[model samples]
Target: MKAIIVDDERLARKELASLLASHPEIEIVDEAANPDEAVEKIEKHDPDVVFLDIQMPGKTGFEMLEEMERVPQVIFTTAYDEFALKAFDYNALDYLLKPIQPERLTESLNKVTIKSAKSEGKDQKLSSKDQVFVKDGDKCWFVKLEEVRLFESDGNYIKVYFDKFKPMIHKSLNALDERLDDRHFFRASRKHIINLGWVESIDTWFNGGLLVQLKGGEKIEVSRRQSARFREMMSL
Candidate 1:
């Protein structure tokens, strides 16, 4: 994937570039010294990812993101850990502390590669076999599609229910619906998409809707508009 290193220190930029050289998947397309320069280069290169420093002269990394109309996948390269929690709120791909560890960098790159391929439509659909890396705050998980029981939309984020943990990831419901394998998952309502394998019971509800319960004991209302299709799929 194409990338740009945005840092104020020349040595810091060089060091990161050197480490990235060992990873064949990452191509260093450009470098920038400050927020202004970074913004200009990012628009010019349209890189897949940006290695951003949290602290810069004129602006912080988060401020830089606000300036972009279409922000790409961001991997924050900073010396502070305090901003780690806030970084995920921006839906950053990963957080790499300054003087980055090679192992950690590789882990972050793996996630970026998986996400980048899916975003670029290199993968038509994600099946039950596909694994996704999800990060909420400082916690992270590599979960297979089959393991998720429900996806509840909350504004711009989706609450992903898997096993016993419910973690939120930054993504829109409509965008995710297009990529999911319909045979294994169903969009039951405007706010929910459920895994068919987890359904435990189904019953009639108010206004021609259906009340569906999962093995995990969570109840979901299948919209009146979607109930017919749900019945058809279930009966099939």
Candidate 2:
């Protein structure tokens, strides 16, 4: 894939570029120091993917996205673990922490190049569907977008409820809502977000909210504040 390195530090950029050089599938088209330069180079190069640094001088990586009409697949490179969590909330293609490991980088590349292709053929889309990488202790799963029934707030982390598993990921529900496509996932209450596609039944509940049951038998309560929109979205 055509790619570019965007980092404020020259040494950091060089290090990632050098490692990327070993992969024949990845071709570095250009490099940029800050968001502005990155934007310019991106428009000029039109690379297939970007290795973006979250913390830059003027604008962070997210701020750079507003300048583009269409964003390419992004693999964020950052030192802060907090920012990496936020990056995942944005549904970024992948995240590589600083002192990037070769195995991790290879795995991320495989996801972007091979898994993404399979996802496209399998009908996963940015607006209507998505896949989330969930790692719980020693277990890992590449969860399909449709299978996600609900997302619950768990202190500083969000607990993803799907199938028979409930995995706690280091992200807030608000952040996850912002990343999720509105057409598929909606904030049903202060602490819960539900996937519309997974709702098997809906009924009016106390305080003007609605009760939703998923195919997997999980019952989620949609709060009164969002009930009106929920009804409209469900055409009721």
The candidate that wins on lDDT is 1
Candidate 1: segments with Cα more than 4 A from true spot: 1-11, 30-52, 55-75, 82-94, 101-148, 151-185, 195-208
Q: What lDDT score is found at residue 119 in candidate 1?
A: 33
Looking at candidate 1, what is the lDDT of residue 98?
A: 78
Report lDDT (CA) for all predictions.
Answer: 0.82, 0.77
TM-scores vs. true structure, each candidate:
0.55, 0.52
TM-score of 1: 0.55
Clashes of 1: 0
Per-residue C-alpha lDDT of model 2 across residues 109-187, encoded as one tens digit per residue = 8866432332232223344434445655534444666778888998998888877889787777886677677899889
Please give the lDDT score at residue 28 for candidate 2. 92
